[model samples]
Target: MSEELGMREEPRGRLYRVTHRTVYEYDDDVTSSYGRGFLCPRDFPGQRRIDHELVVDPEPEDSSTGVDAFGNHDLYFHVTQTHRRLVVDAQSTVAVAAEQTSWANWDDWADWEDVRLRLAQEPLVRQYVIDLDPPEITDEVLRWAAPTFAARRPLVEVVAELTHRIYKELRYDPGSTTVATKVSEVLAQRSGVCQDFARLAIACLRGHGLAARYVSGYLLTNPPPGQPKLVGADATHAWAAVCFGEDRWLAFDPTNNQLVSDEYITCAWGRDYADVPPLRGVIYSEAKTSTIGVSVDVAEL
Candidate 1:
């Protein structure tokens, strides 16, 4: 089991209305569908979920909600009836607070290798130690991350340096890589989206025997200057969080080269994206071609 961060009773923050809608169109009828969604927000150090709802079209014959191993809320649903199109609309209202100061003096914290050994003794932290099955770690990744993580450097300092290096070195190309892309490919190409960057960061940390997990959530993005904010201009964002101790973890947005803050909303997190995709399912259909479109709006309320 994973640790549950204790959130304050009342945190200072702003309210946001998040609408995430996914539409799937098939060439032929879909006789059955089964899905697991990690769209609900989790209450943590600086965030709280006020209310949430999910609507599934062609209503599922069997559906239930439960907490996963990583303490993320998940919805399981299955559609037994026939259908050609599927729509999943998930909306949530959350209060996101500003980042709080670290509880422990980071400067006094032990070095990376010591912290790694300590984490190995904690069952909760050990869960995130393995490499992601798809994007397996390579020698190149370890080499790239080794310099920043000197044996005597403070753990947090080492993590910050590594994150900054990745931010500075990698180009943010939207379609440069896919979910199946390997970390070695990313290191070679030097370009990828937020998820790819997050994965790379995770691989780097994990290679050093550190515990790191993938964070999935929404980031508030501003509309272009002089233009009105578009209704669905926002998108679900990804980041990486590393275990500082049994009860403390630090999250960083390698995509934006900053620490996670009020502008970010955490939905769920686990070993990797494979554990907490917003929406993924199996469909029983003869459709040869299918298309998917996702629209997200994270509006301050």
Candidate 2:
């Protein structure tokens, strides 16, 4: 299970309101809809979850809320109403914490070998060692990450270099890949979205026998100097976090070539995206075609 990283809002002095909504429209009516979502934000020691609410339209007949295996807010709902459109809306307020030191300064960080040996002795992290059903780690991934995970280099340093390399090598091309894209395909294509980069980083870390998880969240973005802020233009972001030791992990964004900072709002984390999707479900409908639209907005509060 993941522990809350108590960093708190006092240090960063930043608070934000996030709105995420997903809508589905079908050609025919959907008789039964079942959904399980991880749309609520998680609280950390340094980060505070001010408030969060999830709403399902056509009110679910059977709905429940609970904590997941990874300690994230899990929501399950079943909508028995017959409809052609379905909506899931989530709103949250959060206080983010900032890291005082730069990731480039890794003097006190643990070495790769020592961290690996220590983690190997811990039997509780069985899930991290095992790959997903299809498996993402490959020989190419290990070989690509080999230069960074040299014998005794500081673990943080290795992670930073790996992130930088990915950011430099990969191109961010929207609509180039989908959630089904594999790590191998990403490497060969050299282009992907944030989730792709995050998964690739996770694959690299796992290829070295290190534990890493996928982080889903939002990132504060500013428009160009003269451009006005666009409402409902924000998108969810993804990053990767590597375990340093017990109850401590280091998160880095290969898409941005930097460590996760106060600008990020973590919602949930898991072994992969399948573990924590914003909205996913099954609909028993005779509709042959359906379309989904997502709108997210992150505003300073």
Candidate 3:
């Protein structure tokens, strides 16, 4: 169940197209079930635009799901259960383009200051800013041993090193925390999933006079030996993206202990999960439980 799924797209001239599908099935004979799904968010730079459609079988059914247009992302959710069966399908065609063509320098904070001000005005994003506690950059944490990383020991370097150290100090336990869990709780427990890790990183980065946000998306895995291509499997993932300088936001995945490469498929970016839950909504069902299944396949066109 903990396997890393593979998903890769082959280029066709200057463009690459990717399609993603997800299905959820429930067998628990409960009276109801609830679920949520996310849509194409603005942070997915390579994607041009996205369209979504919902299909529910039978004429009159007691089920409800819709998209939340708050923040810079869109999310949808629903709750209900029928004795017969229930199925939800979401499909999207993502258009890929060349990478960002700009380089940012350290002294460009003036340019990013505007962006920071704008993001801080949003109600959802403002909450993250208010919630973050200033990180205690102690000499002990700063002096942690890492001879290989000694040369890059400026403030930015310290932030990166501390964040990486925090990731290493924490355990990757998916069930240890939920979306509603607080960063303080995760820090205290020293364990959590990708979401928790991402949130912790963002908070820490922002604490150090840097702009960082939560990135919800999929991680493209390396194909096993003899496998020709990569494909995504049963779950969506999350990470963090820190604004290095100016408009430049570089991604870092502490869960996997790696830098963002061509394999990271971005879906959305915001201060935290509340701004971009892959899927969320209101449901009319009196009682409910839910399950999710996702798969991604990438191949040469």
In order, the Cα lDDT scores of the candidates are 0.82, 0.82, 0.52
Per-candidate RMSD vs. true structure? 4.5, 4.0, 7.8
Which tens-of-lDDT digit does each residue in 66-127 have in candidate 2?
A: 89999999889999999999988888888888753478654447787888877887766657
Best lDDT among the predictions, by candidate number = 2
Candidate 2 clash pair list = 5-45, 5-46, 6-45, 6-46, 7-45, 7-46, 8-46
The local lDDT score (0 to 100) that residue 55 gets in candidate 2 is 80
TM-score of each: 0.89, 0.90, 0.62
Task: Write model 1 residue lDDT over 253-288, tens digit each, in one string.
Answer: 787766776777899999888888989999999999
Ranking by TM-score: 2, 1, 3
Candidate 1: deviation at residue 33, Å? 1.5
Worst 10 residues of 3 by lDDT: 1-10
TM-score comparison, 2 vs 3, better candidate: 2
* Reference-based TM-score, model 1: 0.89
Error of 1 at 21 (Å): 0.4
Q: Pairing residues by index, what is the TM-score of model 2?
A: 0.90
Clash count per candidate = 0, 7, 12
Poorly placed runs, candidate 1 (over 4 Å)? 1-10, 101-109, 223-233
